[model samples]
Target: MTPTLQAFVLVSGALFSIGLLAALSRRHAIFILIGIELMLAAANLNFIAFWHFAPQPHQPTGVMFAIFSIAISAAEAAIGLAMVIAVYRHYHTTNVDQLDQLKG
Candidate 1:
Protein backbone atom coordinates (compact mmCIF):
# COMPACT_ATOMS: atom_id res chain seq x y z
CA MET A 1 0.00 0.00 0.00
CA THR A 2 1.05 3.57 -0.65
CA PRO A 3 2.33 5.54 2.31
CA THR A 4 0.01 8.11 3.89
CA LEU A 5 0.63 11.83 4.22
CA GLN A 6 1.22 11.46 7.94
CA ALA A 7 3.89 8.88 7.28
CA PHE A 8 5.72 11.16 4.87
CA VAL A 9 5.50 14.05 7.30
CA LEU A 10 6.79 11.93 10.16
CA VAL A 11 9.72 10.74 8.09
CA SER A 12 10.52 14.27 7.04
CA GLY A 13 10.43 15.41 10.66
CA ALA A 14 12.77 12.63 11.64
CA LEU A 15 15.17 13.57 8.88
CA PHE A 16 15.09 17.22 9.90
CA SER A 17 15.72 16.35 13.53
CA ILE A 18 18.64 14.14 12.63
CA GLY A 19 20.09 16.79 10.38
CA LEU A 20 19.73 19.46 13.02
CA LEU A 21 21.39 17.32 15.62
CA ALA A 22 24.25 16.48 13.31
CA ALA A 23 24.72 20.07 12.26
CA LEU A 24 24.80 21.34 15.83
CA SER A 25 26.89 18.59 17.37
CA ARG A 26 29.55 18.09 14.72
CA ARG A 27 32.90 19.80 14.96
CA HIS A 28 34.11 19.13 11.42
CA ALA A 29 33.21 21.48 8.58
CA ILE A 30 32.48 18.57 6.26
CA PHE A 31 30.09 17.05 8.74
CA ILE A 32 28.28 20.33 9.07
CA LEU A 33 27.96 20.54 5.32
CA ILE A 34 26.54 17.02 5.24
CA GLY A 35 24.03 17.93 7.91
CA ILE A 36 22.94 20.99 5.97
CA GLU A 37 22.49 18.85 2.89
CA LEU A 38 20.38 16.43 4.88
CA MET A 39 18.23 19.26 6.10
CA LEU A 40 17.76 20.46 2.56
CA ALA A 41 16.79 16.95 1.51
CA ALA A 42 14.17 16.88 4.24
CA ALA A 43 12.74 20.12 2.95
CA ASN A 44 12.65 18.70 -0.55
CA LEU A 45 10.85 15.64 0.75
CA ASN A 46 8.21 17.86 2.32
CA PHE A 47 7.76 19.77 -0.91
CA ILE A 48 7.26 16.55 -2.83
CA ALA A 49 4.83 15.18 -0.26
CA PHE A 50 2.73 18.32 -0.29
CA TRP A 51 2.75 18.40 -4.03
CA HIS A 52 1.62 14.80 -4.24
CA PHE A 53 -1.29 15.55 -1.92
CA ALA A 54 -2.35 18.80 -3.53
CA PRO A 55 -5.61 18.88 -5.46
CA GLN A 56 -3.94 20.35 -8.51
CA PRO A 57 -0.78 18.35 -8.83
CA HIS A 58 -0.90 18.98 -12.54
CA GLN A 59 0.01 22.62 -11.97
CA PRO A 60 3.65 21.56 -11.34
CA THR A 61 4.52 24.53 -9.16
CA GLY A 62 5.62 22.41 -6.25
CA VAL A 63 7.70 20.18 -8.48
CA MET A 64 9.34 23.18 -10.04
CA PHE A 65 10.14 24.60 -6.62
CA ALA A 66 11.63 21.36 -5.50
CA ILE A 67 13.79 21.18 -8.60
CA PHE A 68 14.95 24.72 -8.07
CA SER A 69 15.71 23.93 -4.45
CA ILE A 70 17.76 20.95 -5.48
CA ALA A 71 19.77 23.11 -7.83
CA ILE A 72 20.33 25.65 -5.10
CA SER A 73 21.35 22.95 -2.69
CA ALA A 74 23.92 21.69 -5.14
CA ALA A 75 25.39 25.14 -5.50
CA GLU A 76 25.42 25.54 -1.74
CA ALA A 77 27.20 22.26 -1.33
CA ALA A 78 29.83 23.24 -3.87
CA ILE A 79 30.50 26.56 -2.19
CA GLY A 80 30.51 25.07 1.28
CA LEU A 81 32.91 22.35 0.24
CA ALA A 82 35.21 24.82 -1.40
CA MET A 83 35.31 26.91 1.73
CA VAL A 84 35.98 23.84 3.80
CA ILE A 85 38.86 22.92 1.54
CA ALA A 86 40.33 26.39 1.73
CA VAL A 87 40.01 26.40 5.51
CA TYR A 88 41.60 23.00 5.73
CA ARG A 89 44.50 24.06 3.59
CA HIS A 90 45.14 27.11 5.72
CA TYR A 91 44.50 25.66 9.16
CA HIS A 92 45.63 22.08 8.49
CA THR A 93 42.51 20.89 10.28
CA THR A 94 38.83 20.51 9.56
CA ASN A 95 37.65 21.18 13.10
CA VAL A 96 35.18 24.05 13.32
CA ASP A 97 36.67 25.40 16.56
CA GLN A 98 40.15 25.57 15.08
CA LEU A 99 38.84 27.61 12.15
CA ASP A 100 38.54 30.65 14.40
CA GLN A 101 42.31 30.64 14.94
CA LEU A 102 42.95 31.37 11.28
CA LYS A 103 44.89 34.60 10.84
CA GLY A 104 45.42 36.78 7.81
Candidate 2:
Protein backbone atom coordinates (compact mmCIF):
# COMPACT_ATOMS: atom_id res chain seq x y z
CA MET A 1 0.00 0.00 0.00
CA THR A 2 1.00 3.61 -0.54
CA PRO A 3 2.18 5.86 2.29
CA THR A 4 -1.08 7.83 2.17
CA LEU A 5 -3.18 4.70 2.48
CA GLN A 6 -0.98 3.41 5.26
CA ALA A 7 -1.31 6.68 7.12
CA PHE A 8 -5.08 6.70 6.74
CA VAL A 9 -5.40 3.16 8.02
CA LEU A 10 -3.13 3.89 10.96
CA VAL A 11 -5.06 6.98 11.90
CA SER A 12 -8.37 5.21 11.60
CA GLY A 13 -7.11 2.35 13.74
CA ALA A 14 -5.87 4.76 16.39
CA LEU A 15 -9.17 6.62 16.41
CA PHE A 16 -11.15 3.39 16.73
CA SER A 17 -8.99 2.16 19.59
CA ILE A 18 -9.24 5.47 21.44
CA GLY A 19 -12.99 5.59 21.00
CA LEU A 20 -13.31 2.06 22.32
CA LEU A 21 -11.18 2.91 25.32
CA ALA A 22 -13.21 6.01 26.06
CA ALA A 23 -16.46 4.10 25.87
CA LEU A 24 -15.16 1.43 28.22
CA SER A 25 -13.77 3.88 30.76
CA ARG A 26 -16.72 6.24 31.10
CA ARG A 27 -19.41 5.80 33.74
CA HIS A 28 -21.51 8.89 33.01
CA ALA A 29 -24.33 8.19 30.58
CA ILE A 30 -23.62 11.28 28.47
CA PHE A 31 -19.91 10.52 28.24
CA ILE A 32 -20.64 6.96 27.24
CA LEU A 33 -22.98 8.20 24.53
CA ILE A 34 -20.34 10.63 23.31
CA GLY A 35 -17.84 7.80 23.18
CA ILE A 36 -20.22 5.74 21.04
CA GLU A 37 -20.60 8.70 18.72
CA LEU A 38 -16.85 8.98 18.49
CA MET A 39 -16.60 5.32 17.55
CA LEU A 40 -19.21 5.75 14.85
CA ALA A 41 -17.34 8.74 13.45
CA ALA A 42 -14.11 6.77 13.41
CA ALA A 43 -15.79 3.99 11.48
CA ASN A 44 -17.15 6.51 9.01
CA LEU A 45 -13.71 8.00 8.54
CA ASN A 46 -12.30 4.57 7.83
CA PHE A 47 -14.99 3.92 5.26
CA ILE A 48 -14.25 7.17 3.46
CA ALA A 49 -10.53 6.58 3.56
CA PHE A 50 -10.90 3.10 2.12
CA TRP A 51 -13.16 4.38 -0.62
CA HIS A 52 -10.68 7.04 -1.56
CA PHE A 53 -7.78 4.60 -1.85
CA ALA A 54 -9.43 1.46 -3.12
CA PRO A 55 -8.92 0.72 -6.85
CA GLN A 56 -12.43 -0.33 -7.74
CA PRO A 57 -15.53 1.02 -9.46
CA HIS A 58 -17.58 0.31 -6.36
CA GLN A 59 -15.76 2.92 -4.29
CA PRO A 60 -18.93 4.95 -3.96
CA THR A 61 -20.52 2.15 -1.99
CA GLY A 62 -18.32 2.92 0.97
CA VAL A 63 -19.31 6.56 0.84
CA MET A 64 -22.98 5.66 0.65
CA PHE A 65 -22.64 3.37 3.65
CA ALA A 66 -20.83 6.13 5.53
CA ILE A 67 -23.68 8.54 4.85
CA PHE A 68 -26.24 6.03 6.04
CA SER A 69 -24.18 5.29 9.12
CA ILE A 70 -23.98 8.98 9.95
CA ALA A 71 -27.73 9.38 9.66
CA ILE A 72 -28.30 6.35 11.87
CA SER A 73 -25.81 7.65 14.40
CA ALA A 74 -27.63 10.95 14.55
CA ALA A 75 -30.93 9.22 15.15
CA GLU A 76 -29.31 7.01 17.78
CA ALA A 77 -27.95 10.05 19.60
CA ALA A 78 -31.31 11.75 19.62
CA ILE A 79 -33.09 8.70 20.96
CA GLY A 80 -30.35 7.96 23.46
CA LEU A 81 -30.40 11.50 24.79
CA ALA A 82 -34.14 11.34 25.23
CA MET A 83 -33.77 8.10 27.13
CA VAL A 84 -31.05 9.62 29.29
CA ILE A 85 -33.29 12.52 30.12
CA ALA A 86 -36.06 10.17 31.13
CA VAL A 87 -33.71 8.11 33.27
CA TYR A 88 -32.33 11.21 34.95
CA ARG A 89 -35.81 12.40 35.72
CA HIS A 90 -36.57 9.16 37.51
CA TYR A 91 -33.16 8.46 39.14
CA HIS A 92 -31.82 12.00 39.58
CA THR A 93 -28.43 10.95 38.28
CA THR A 94 -26.65 10.31 34.98
CA ASN A 95 -23.99 8.05 36.36
CA VAL A 96 -24.38 4.47 35.17
CA ASP A 97 -23.16 3.17 38.50
CA GLN A 98 -26.28 4.48 40.22
CA LEU A 99 -28.55 2.54 37.87
CA ASP A 100 -28.71 -0.64 39.86
CA GLN A 101 -32.42 -1.18 39.64
CA LEU A 102 -32.12 -2.91 36.29
CA LYS A 103 -29.55 -5.38 37.56
CA GLY A 104 -31.36 -8.66 37.32
Candidate 3:
Protein backbone atom coordinates (compact mmCIF):
# COMPACT_ATOMS: atom_id res chain seq x y z
CA MET A 1 0.00 0.00 0.00
CA THR A 2 1.06 3.57 -0.63
CA PRO A 3 2.17 5.73 2.27
CA THR A 4 -0.92 7.91 1.98
CA LEU A 5 -3.22 4.90 1.99
CA GLN A 6 -1.38 3.40 4.94
CA ALA A 7 -1.77 6.62 6.89
CA PHE A 8 -5.45 6.81 6.07
CA VAL A 9 -5.98 3.23 7.22
CA LEU A 10 -4.22 3.92 10.47
CA VAL A 11 -6.24 7.05 11.11
CA SER A 12 -9.46 5.28 10.32
CA GLY A 13 -8.55 2.41 12.58
CA ALA A 14 -7.81 4.78 15.43
CA LEU A 15 -11.11 6.59 14.87
CA PHE A 16 -13.01 3.31 14.82
CA SER A 17 -11.37 2.18 18.03
CA ILE A 18 -12.15 5.45 19.76
CA GLY A 19 -15.73 5.27 18.60
CA LEU A 20 -16.06 1.73 19.87
CA LEU A 21 -14.71 2.77 23.23
CA ALA A 22 -17.10 5.70 23.42
CA ALA A 23 -20.06 3.55 22.49
CA LEU A 24 -19.17 0.90 25.00
CA SER A 25 -18.56 3.33 27.85
CA ARG A 26 -21.58 5.54 27.43
CA ARG A 27 -24.90 4.84 29.05
CA HIS A 28 -26.79 7.67 27.34
CA ALA A 29 -28.63 6.42 24.30
CA ILE A 30 -27.91 9.53 22.23
CA PHE A 31 -24.21 9.46 23.06
CA ILE A 32 -24.08 5.81 22.19
CA LEU A 33 -25.77 6.56 18.87
CA ILE A 34 -23.24 9.31 18.22
CA GLY A 35 -20.44 6.90 18.88
CA ILE A 36 -21.99 4.37 16.52
CA GLU A 37 -22.21 7.03 13.85
CA LEU A 38 -18.58 7.92 14.41
CA MET A 39 -17.63 4.32 13.93
CA LEU A 40 -19.65 4.19 10.71
CA ALA A 41 -17.93 7.33 9.50
CA ALA A 42 -14.56 5.79 10.21
CA ALA A 43 -15.50 2.73 8.21
CA ASN A 44 -16.72 4.93 5.39
CA LEU A 45 -13.46 6.83 5.42
CA ASN A 46 -11.50 3.62 5.17
CA PHE A 47 -13.69 2.43 2.31
CA ILE A 48 -13.18 5.62 0.38
CA ALA A 49 -9.45 5.59 1.02
CA PHE A 50 -9.18 2.00 -0.11
CA TRP A 51 -11.27 2.78 -3.17
CA HIS A 52 -8.94 5.60 -4.07
CA PHE A 53 -5.87 3.37 -3.84
CA ALA A 54 -7.33 0.23 -5.40
CA PRO A 55 -6.38 -1.16 -8.80
CA GLN A 56 -8.17 0.76 -11.52
CA PRO A 57 -10.80 -1.82 -12.39
CA HIS A 58 -11.74 -2.52 -8.78
CA GLN A 59 -11.87 1.13 -7.72
CA PRO A 60 -15.34 1.78 -9.05
CA THR A 61 -16.79 -1.17 -7.19
CA GLY A 62 -15.36 0.03 -3.91
CA VAL A 63 -16.77 3.47 -4.51
CA MET A 64 -20.16 2.02 -5.32
CA PHE A 65 -20.15 0.00 -2.16
CA ALA A 66 -19.13 3.04 -0.18
CA ILE A 67 -22.00 5.03 -1.62
CA PHE A 68 -24.45 2.29 -0.81
CA SER A 69 -23.10 2.04 2.68
CA ILE A 70 -23.51 5.77 3.16
CA ALA A 71 -27.14 5.53 2.18
CA ILE A 72 -27.69 2.64 4.52
CA SER A 73 -25.97 4.48 7.33
CA ALA A 74 -28.19 7.48 6.81
CA ALA A 75 -31.29 5.35 6.99
CA GLU A 76 -29.98 3.63 10.06
CA ALA A 77 -29.26 6.93 11.78
CA ALA A 78 -32.73 8.22 10.99
CA ILE A 79 -34.43 5.15 12.31
CA GLY A 80 -32.18 4.97 15.32
CA LEU A 81 -32.67 8.60 16.24
CA ALA A 82 -36.43 8.24 15.84
CA MET A 83 -36.39 5.27 18.18
CA VAL A 84 -34.26 7.22 20.64
CA ILE A 85 -36.68 10.07 20.60
CA ALA A 86 -39.59 7.76 21.15
CA VAL A 87 -37.78 6.07 23.98
CA TYR A 88 -36.97 9.39 25.57
CA ARG A 89 -40.62 10.41 25.38
CA HIS A 90 -41.73 7.20 26.97
CA TYR A 91 -39.09 7.08 29.66
CA HIS A 92 -38.09 10.71 30.06
CA THR A 93 -34.47 9.70 30.22
CA THR A 94 -31.78 8.88 27.67
CA ASN A 95 -29.65 6.74 29.93
CA VAL A 96 -29.65 3.05 29.10
CA ASP A 97 -29.21 2.20 32.76
CA GLN A 98 -32.66 3.58 33.48
CA LEU A 99 -34.26 1.23 30.99
CA ASP A 100 -34.87 -1.77 33.18
CA GLN A 101 -38.60 -2.16 32.69
CA LEU A 102 -38.11 -4.36 29.67
CA LYS A 103 -36.48 -6.94 31.89
CA GLY A 104 -39.76 -7.85 33.51
Alpha carbon lDDT of each predicted model: 0.90, 0.89, 0.88
Best by lDDT: 1
Weakest lDDT window of 10 consecutive positions for candidate 2: 1-10
By TM-score, the best candidate is: 1
How well is each residue in 1-104 modelled by candidate 1, as lDDT tens digits? 99899999999999999999889999988889899999999999999998899886378877899999999999999999999898878778999987675355
TM-score of 1: 0.92
Cα lDDT of model 2 by residue, 8-101, tens digit = 8888888888888878998999988888888899899889988998886664888999999999999999999999999999999999988999
Worst 10 residues of 1 by lDDT: 95-104
On the 0 to 100 scale, the lDDT of residue 17 in model 3 is: 90
Against the correct fold, how does model 3 do in TM-score?
0.88
What residue pairs clash in candidate 1, if any at all? none
Name every residue pair that clashes in candidate 3.
none
Which candidate order results from sorting by TM-score in descending order?
1, 2, 3
